[model samples]
Target: MTCSATTRVALWATLLACLLNSGCTGTRYIPSQGQLASPTPPPQALKGFDGNARVELNLPGGYASPDDRAYPTQRANEDIQNWFADSGDDLTVAVRNENIKDSGWLSMLPYILTLGILPTWLTTEGETVMEVKSGDEVLFQNREPVAYRSALSMLLPSAYLLGSPGTGQYQVMADDQLNRHKQALQQYIQSQQKDYETAVSAGTVQAYRQYLQDNPESFFRMETLRRLSELAPATHALPFHRDNVALDNAYIVYLPDEYDIWFLGPQDMKVYDVLRLSREEDETLLASRIRAANQPYKVFNGDEIALLKEGGLSPGLIAAMIDASANPTSVKPAAVAPTVTSATSGAASPGTPSPAEVTAQPGMADIAAQCAKRYAAMKACDQVPSFGANVCRSQVKKKYSHIACELIQ
Candidate 1:
């Protein structure tokens, strides 16, 4: 038996490749890299939390068999600990138990013998208990199980290039399982916290109210109410005789005048009356009630009047509103102009007021024009439709009617 020169060379090369591959290959529990390096933990990935909780892994020996046999040499402990290094102080995660099993070093021999063609598999199955706590209070506890299947071949030099053989894949699987536990723990904490801190952190009445609405029985209910009162005391002072306290609370915040009409006591009416009558009441009825109530009229400023008009008060009702105001000069009626004009043009009639004596007031036409402008802006009625002028007038009138702007008449 004689061997060719080429065959001898090939055998030597094959032997060298085997040695290199064996040195680089690793099982799921054992990392292929000679030097074990910890990973930088991911950023704050938990929702509704600042990731201010400290995380700890109690798997002291790192990897272990199902029967309590530990693999103290494995870097799983350092890798997991480093992964959660900066996670936060709000939560502490303790690993109570972990088990990892994988095919040993000899498993890679078959892969090396087959050159780059054949592949060997590494499978790991384990169970871990992760316990979450918040300052001596346990928030969540759960058992997580992991099963990972991977293949090793010489075709890819990822292990050699990364300075680790099968460690990357195994680490990924372990991290994935830990992440799931973290997520579950996060959900549990959120349910317990009920976004109370998030709302408080915002420090706004709207945020506090929203928190109350979302979680009526929130742990921080008293604190939320205190904040709400500080931010907007009116919401708390509003007389709420209704069963739905939340709805009544909103009434004061959004419709204080309407709230007065419906909920004010007879004693309160004298002091807090808005004098803006019910929508169902006619101007005549409103005037009669205003006179009978004998309460000081409620005078609204320009901004208040604009808001009232936008709220769908009719022009006639607005005129009645002006009449109901304590400041009689707020809106001078056009009827007063006739007396002033007569006095100015002719000799000064007895008991007739002069132009200077009569304060200048917004006339009906001026009020009508102002209302029209507001209506146009509020409804975009000035913009003719793509359909052209044929439907423009009707559409404009329809919009005016929708906003109860009687300026068209």
Candidate 2:
């Protein structure tokens, strides 16, 4: 019940330490005079950092995966996300390798505790710098100090110190940090949109590919895809033979001008014209599949066509058929029946006999003379007005003499 002065002092110290929650109170941030190095990501690389009317984080140059737990940006990002959790904000930070820093306390802790030297022990602090981009513009960037004060804090638990500030000043500090990054993210997004417009007006497929691929999760992904689709291959049906059967059923037949002949079989469509073997028949045979391994196709113009037939026909009738097709009315007229005018006149034969030694056969000269006299009488005087002779008189003289003679002699 009655404690000494030194013992009482020790009791107070114990209560104070307990009030600090089994650990030293939080460390505070002082606005130091030094500047943090700003990130210099290319415009395209920063595409998704500001979109959806909200701020996004992109650290492609930071930790590649959670496997890189010691990465400085990753560590800082975890702190910021935890801080934002209470604010109902979702914060996701992409990681890259360069974000693994050599300056973080926990990273150095391994070397310090492992080496156990005075200088290593003295190195109890780390600095973190992040750019808060709105679009393509930066709002605030500060390289802040972080202090570790736990037994295991030397090699671990750096995140607890990253987003934390001095005791009794959490709301103010967290708000300050959030606002800075939010502004920067918004500015970055606006710049990105403007750049996208300029690029799209005169854009190429390569540029669109870069933007779309790099920022696949960007808010403008659909828009980017629209532009990309313009450059992508169209996905429609090509010139395919649709709803058709038997590609080999049709043939383009041709005839060249050369020989006259009836084109024989393989009749399909009858062509009406003079059938002349195509002068190109030899060439055609040479190029045909029957002659060569492959058939190199050839076209026959209208001029080369003499006939078109659908049925097999001989070469002999081809020329005749062509002529008939060309001129439909070249047939001779039919004969007419003759009328008998005199009973003594028999039907005349459609034949002629020789005039000289002609009217008499060798053994029938007398009968021939009698017939010639009758024939000469039947002839009109107009047949030989100057000599009082006619074609029949000449015939009668030849019948009497075996040689042709003047009618008067």
Candidate 3:
């Protein structure tokens, strides 16, 4: 179909115009750089962006249920008192207001729904103060007895004692409550000590050991150990031999001390049974027993070790536990493995600087001076210890040990 030049030119022009207007052809898709205009505003407010919005921190298991109403009035009073004590002054009212306003569940309900239910009573009255006198002397003055009672109830459950106001009392009763509580605890400890003595006198070591083994979680462990340490023999014969020395059980007996020695049972079948050796020979004999047939052996200090031993742990495990117990600000768990060296032999050698020794050792004065010279370099010494003249000695020794071992091979 042959067309005139003017007609062809006109058709091409129309096609180009259509493509440009539609933005459908010959268009590259480049992402927009500038701010984009939204068709609609954001559907919901972003978290933390709602600055004026109220925040509610709900109780763990929500409000008490019908089953909890057995001691309804008392429980409610206790809860109110606990809240006041913890929040400190006017907290009950503030919390109630917050709960009503910010709670999503409460807001969704009809206004009439709140009117149908009885509202919880929260006392707004400031702490009451009272003053009292006995004869010519003033015994007590205006005191917030309720607040103190509430605080004590929450802080110490067993220690809180209820008291009745005396005749014509204008002030809260002042009794020796703290002294009474302390006396009660002391009495209990004394009673426990007597019972422990009786148990020791009446039973054999095996019986006592069995009692300890069975009731591992008993709070009496420390007391029992104290008693045992006192009763343990003072002297031993050389090459002392004891039958059925329960190493695992002894671990449960004493708390870990610096001088405590753990004798590990042999690793292989041909190796000897494990024995725990103390600094004192007699104590070792007391703890040891002749190896029994068919007794199970553990590779690492397991639950058995923890259950029996005072520290109930191996040297490696004890070191880890000690590191864990250190203050978070002073010590970090991640740094423990790389720092502390467990004493495998008699004691860690003085010549060898353990990871702990390395960390604990202070930087040299020269290093500190060099660091002080530069404003940005002040904290550089904290990265590693700067030893004085003895620097690099350990490193060189370690290298030599490796070389010597290789040469001998």
Candidate 4:
């Protein structure tokens, strides 16, 4: 070979070797695109939790029937646990054994040679879901995908060979998800400044209707609707539904506070009628909850609920009371002996305060209104739904995503 040709070959070999070795030890990457550069955290309205919160994690399933999964569910579980370990002081996270096909992915690479110039379209996507419950009621749920990206490298193009499939990206996504959940929780507490009681006390059917409309994604939607119907069974007879992906089974109806929330089904059916139709075993349980909250004119508050629970009152019973107090006219009188016992064994104990609805503190309303403006901006933009997905590849994608403000969920 000519001297110059030998020199060129040596240079190519050395460059390739460096690329292969450096790939494994590159500085960790933090993605800047498709995220809120300065997202105003969501508004929340809630009393400080009385005790530590419990979180339950549901594992991810395979996207396709790959006997060998790309992102194993257990690994995702570990990711979540490690995340909470840092920020979750008064919170506990546990796993639910059931699995789901949590996410899917796609890529583009017309020519292998292009891998050198462009990302070889290596993406691994998976969704992680966790739920928090206060008693039987799910306070909220969160599900978000952690997408992994790795460019094609001639030395180790196949991610499996490296045994580290997008590890850094996975960590970033997991941290982001945890932060979002924490923000949502704070916003929830803020929202309570305008609780069902506030909506009910406002007394307009419009108020009830507006509450549901403004918070279509709220966890308390179904129960809120049920309360509205009770306050004005005939006036608020209109049926409403939510369009959000997470709230498929939710709806509103006029049922007595005594009705078992779990007992809902076959819409338009009265509570007593449904109760009569339930299975023998379920019927007994339903009956017990109903009897505890059976008062025709009583509101149930959660704090007072712990006292009643030992007496067999279900957590859902407290939900019914919160709903009842929403009515401006639903008077909260002193707890009477006959009512207490009737509600639970009908034996009254004096000095037990009636379930009192707390008045709204200030500032929460302002937070909610601001979030509304943010939501409006996102809906009006023309770009793709997310930067991570890169739904639109137009020259104007960046400009439009900026208009979007924040991811809509």
TM-score of each: 0.29, 0.23, 0.23, 0.28
> lDDT (0-100) at residue 74 of candidate 4?
38
Error of 1 at 407 (Å): 70
The candidate maximizing lDDT is 1
Tens-digit lDDT track of model 4 for 67-124: 2232233344554444332333222333232333322223223213443332233334
Task: Give the residue spans of candidate 4 off by over 4 A.
Answer: 1-33, 36-121, 134-137, 152-168, 196-409
Backbone atom clashes (below 3 Å) for every candidate = 7, 37, 16, 16
- Ranking of predictions according to lDDT: 1, 4, 2, 3
In model 3, what lDDT does residue 339 have?
A: 13
TM-score of 1: 0.29
- Clash count in backbone of candidate 3: 16
Name the regions of candidate 3 deviating beyond 4 angstroms. Answer: 1-175, 210-219, 230-339, 342-409
RMSD of each: 21.4, 42.2, 28.9, 20.0
lDDT of 1 by residue, 122-209 (tens): 5555666766454455545777665544444566543333223434544554555456565665565466455678666778766766
lDDT pick, better of 1 and 2: 1
lDDT agreement of model 4 with the native: 0.35
Candidate 1 clashing pairs, residues 3+ apart or interchain: 52-88, 52-89, 53-88, 53-89, 53-90, 53-91, 54-88
Stronger candidate by lDDT (1 vs 4): 1
Residue-level lDDT tens digits of model 3 in 1-409: 3568889999988875443222111101111232221222111211101111111212112122223212222322333233221322111111111112112234213312332122211111222222212222322232221111110011122111221111111111111211222233344435655765666675554555554555443324434433444444444311111211232232222322211122211122111222233222343232332122221112223533443243322344333223322223332211211111112111224454433432343221112111112111112211212110011222222222322122221
For candidate 3, the TM-score is 0.23
What Cα-based lDDT does every candidate model obtain?
A: 0.41, 0.30, 0.26, 0.35
Off by over 4 Å in 1: 1-22, 26-90, 95-122, 149-166, 189-409
